[model samples]
Target chain A: MEMTVAEALVECLERENVEVVFGYPGGAVLPLYDALYHSTRIRHVLVRHEQGGVHAADGYARVSGKVGVCIATSGPGATNLVTGIANAYMDSVPLVLFTGQVPTIQIGTDAFQEVDITGITLPITKHNCLLKDPSKLAIVVKNAFHIASTGRPGPVLIDIPKDVAQARISFKYPSTVRLRGYKPTYKGHPAKINEIAKLIGKAKRPIIYAGGGVLASNASEELLKFAEAISAPVTNTFMGLAGFPGDHPLFLGMLGLHGTRYANLAITECDLLIGLGARFDDRVVMNITSFAPHATVVHIDIDPAEIGKVIATNVPLVGDVKLILKELLPLIEKVDRSEWLERIKSLKAQYPLSYNRDSGLKPQFIIEQLWNCTKGDAVIVTDVGQHQMWVAQYYHFKKPRTLVSSGGLGCMGFGLPASVGAALAAHPGCKVVLVTGDGSIQMTIQELATMMEQGLSVKIILFNNSALGMVRQLQQYYCQGRHMATHFQFHPDFEILAKAYGIPAYTFRTEEDVIKGLPEVLESPGPAFVNCIIPPEENVLPMVPIGKGISETIECE
Target chain B: MEKHTLSVLVENSPGVLTRVAGLFARRGFNIDSLAVGRTDRDDVSRMTIVVEGDKPLIEQVTKQLHKLIDVIKISNITEDEYVDRELVMIKVAAEPSQRVEIMHIAGIFRARVVDLGSKTMTFECTGNEGKINAFEESLRPYGIKELVRTGKIAMLRGSKFVALSLAQAREAESA
Candidate 1:
């Protein structure tokens, strides 16, 4: 049927099963927004800023395992999505971003709201296209979603000129994409799978280093079975948190910088480092040469480039990890790794992750309590900084996609906006929690109005430390304790701020207050905020300082 | 670092060259030369990229290039039995006295005198890198006024191929 390109774009989205798109409209995208207005099947979320829209989409994608869609107008609106796009790219989140461009005639004329968005986002996006023809709109949209959600998923951008969006065309959404270059390997080589099975059978101290790809592949069950079969301790990267059950006996918690003491130690001591859907990031693999020095690293990932890009891979299996794990499961001989398991238990006992009880109103305590209140079922979205690390450290995530924080990009203002999307994507009765710091929350604080407007029951846990705790800790250790520009001298009263946004607010100044107020805040019917004041001096402990191996960790401040 | 020639087949789409070039520039992969043109199939374009890097660096480049959506196929033809060519045009300052000597050099190197001027003679040559370099060197003493060269373009010996079918491509990726 014939329709405007904008309407056709909306129709294409509906065909792709996209329920909502987070966006902020502008002059260039007026036609597209108009089309969105006429569509009843798809909901358009009006975010405060373009960045918020993208992040919210990212959060939604992370939780729901679907291609999150976001839209923005030309120039500044497009530019504002850069960071969020990069964040998604780094973390391998599947997102389709539609940006409005100036009319084709005015594209290169430096017209108002004109920008070369496709060129700007080239390095960040997995794939991008500037749709110049009206007829190609459906195909481009189809390609965008296909490329975005496939193996090793990441953000894909489609820049539609204003004229292209307004032009009428016979819309026919392609049922299948035929990209010669975009084929992703899904099945692991049979020989390689056999080799891995043999390695697992022979291994004494085996550890499964799982990352976000495990969750991306939805291979949590396979991972569980494999770990249990081989009796290997599973250490998660920060992105890999919640991929394996946190309460499992074989779970080694998050490993790398700021990881649990035992998790890092296990990586150092393990003989067989089974890297499952995990790229050894610099943050995760602190010193390349010494990292898993005693181990034979078997890397199974979807992206071939990541195999030996950083850490050398002895056995590189390039395919979808879930499928790979499923294939290798039956071939595995159950190994009794009692000695290694006992060693890990002793190590965990020796280096328990503990914070000082002397410190007042601890962020760790709040996260733990939040975990208890939600019964480890909440989708905990967090912003970067000390509070984010605290959640990663303390929150016992028993399920995959439960912890939705910015892992690779570590963007500071990710929590509130991301929680907005997480809340929307989550299953009914599933609580969405936002853990933000005083410094991190203020970056995208306007998102509070968004939460209130949407009436999303996101439980906001603000760890007000009065300073950028992570950087301050770095300054303290690395910069001779000169805490310049890290401390916040004066901040707005968050309780009053929450009230202005028409959300209930609470302040936890003491331990007794947290014991009384935290559960009540979490249990509130609508959106609620709790400003839990913590000491600025506290640091995320057991950090593997820069240039050092994971074994050389700072246990305490 | 060794010079590695990569014959890459990509979709003949707008900005495909930019995607290829931008990748090299941003990833710090040094491109010695890059020649791109439409292939036999109009929908597909072939790019011959001569890059300077070690074995691992070349592998990294190949893997990264393969990730691009427009990139159809990549062959590191450096070690393959392949025929390579580069085109060069040189304008040498040829006085009446130097004309014969320049012509003799050009004739010996199988270079065609494509253009002639009163003060200079333009020689167009196409050959492997070595032949092109030697031809340019022989005319260097005669005061070369201008020189332009097309980057290296390569193809495998007959029967061997780079553009594989879907099934063959999958097999190649797994291999």
Candidate 2:
């Protein structure tokens, strides 16, 4: 059938089972938006800014386990999506982005609102293409989704020229994609799997270290089973939270700079560290020299580059986490590590994840209260800083894909739009909470308009410290009390901002207010916001000092 | 620092070279020299990148290079006894008096005069790094006007091509 490229693009999205797209309209994307307006198969949520659209897509992808879609025009609109695109790339979120460009004749002539977005985002994207031929749009769309969703998924961009969107093409959507250079290795070698199983069989003090790859590959159940069968304790990276159930007996809550003291201790003393889809990033590896001094590491991942990129591995298996665990399951025998279990118990008893109760309006207490109110049933999104660490520490997520935060990029302004996306994508009755800090909320404060416009239900718990809390903590420790630009000279009233957006707003500055205000915000049906005034001096403790090993973890005392 | 010659096979797609080169630039790993050209296959292009790094650093660089989707295969040819060559075409300012001396120097290096102008002479020379350096220096006194070089290209001395994975090469040997 002969149809315009814009129509075919929408049809292509429908064919891919895309249910929603978060986007903003502009001159270049008029035809595409026009097609969207006439279409019934897909719903488009108009966002206030291009960044909000991309971040919403990212959040939706993280929760929905589907390739999220977003649209923006060329030039400034496209440029605004860079941080969100980079965020998705760093965290391995699958998103297909469509950006409109000027006509081909005026491309290099620097037409109005025309920019080389593909060139600018070349390094950050998994793949990108500029649509030159209208007839090839269908195939390009197929390729973009295929590349974005497979083999360490990331964001992909397709820049459509205004004329190509208006051109007519006899369109037939390509059903399959086979590229010469693009084949992801999905199965581990049998011999290597056996070798790793052998290592697992013999170790007395073994630990199963899981990461975001477990969730990405949907191998959390396998991880739980493996950890059970082997009688090994499981610790997760900050990104790896909820990949293994936080409340499981063998679970060691997050291991990194801000990890639980016992988790750090277990890692410091373990004999064999089996890393599942976890990159040993510098944040986790306090010092390269002695990060896991006593351990022989076995790293399993889908991306071959991550296997030996940082710490050396004794057995490196490059494949999907699920397939690898499935292959390694039958060869393993459960060992009785009573002594190791006892040692771990002792470590946990000696050093627990705890905070002072006397501290005024604590962020950790608020996260715990939020967790209590939701009972681990809600999707928790957090902005970076002390609040993020507090969320990771306090929330005992019992399910995978429940704790969605920016771990790799540590991006602020993530929680608000991401929460909006999560709220829209999640099944009805599932509560979405944005646990954001004061500094972080101001970065993309414009996303509030998106929530109000869409009438989406998002409950926000703002940690209003009147400062960039995490950086302040760092300066207090590292720079000898010389505060740079970490403090806010004057903070805006977020509750008033929420009221202006027509969202219900509440503020809590004391225990009495928290008791009264939190339940009202958490239980309300429509979008709601609560600003909690936390003390300024409180910091996330049990911190592994930069450049020191996990053995030297320090507590608040 | 040790010099390592890495042969990378990539798809001949738009902005692919930029992705490959961009990875190096972003990681602060600079290539000593690089040569690129089409291979026997129409869809694939081969790049020979020479970089100086220690074992671990080079491994990181190679691993990062493989992350680019356009890159198909990579082989570090520095491990084997390989044949390496670079070609240089230099246009040297030569008067009639200096022309004979230039030709004499070029002949000793087994270089050929690819082009000649009224007062300039162009010599094409191909050899190992040492030979190319000496040849270029030999004509430097004539005041060279222009110089262009095809950076080093290398191949293993055996029948093995860099495109073959280890398992594939083993299978080929057994067959």
Compared with the true structure, what per-residue lDDT tens digits does model 2 show for residues B1-175? 7899999988777777888888889888989999999887666688999999999888888878877767778889999889999999999999988889889999999999999999999999999889999999998898989999998999989787677454322321100
Judged by lDDT, which candidate is best? 1
> Please, what is the TM-score per model?
0.98, 0.96
Q: Indicate the docking level reached by candidate 1.
A: acceptable
lDDT of 1 at A338: 98
- Quote the true-contact fraction of every model: 0.61, 0.39
Listed in order, the DockQ scores are: 0.47, 0.34
The DockQ of predicted model 2 stands at 0.34
User: What residue runs in model 2 are displaced by over 4 Å at the alpha carbon?
Assistant: B117-119, B156-158, B162-175
The global Cα lDDT (0 to 1) of model 1 is 0.91
Alpha-carbon deviation at B145 in model 2, angstroms: 3.4
For A463-520, candidate 1 gives per-residue lDDT tens digits of 9988999999999889999999999989999999999998888889888888888888
Interface RMSD for all numbered candidates: 7.1, 8.9
Error of 1 at A234 (Å): 0.3
Error of 1 at A118 (Å): 0.4
lDDT of 2 at A272: 97
Please list the C-alpha lDDT of all candidates, in the order they appear. Answer: 0.91, 0.88
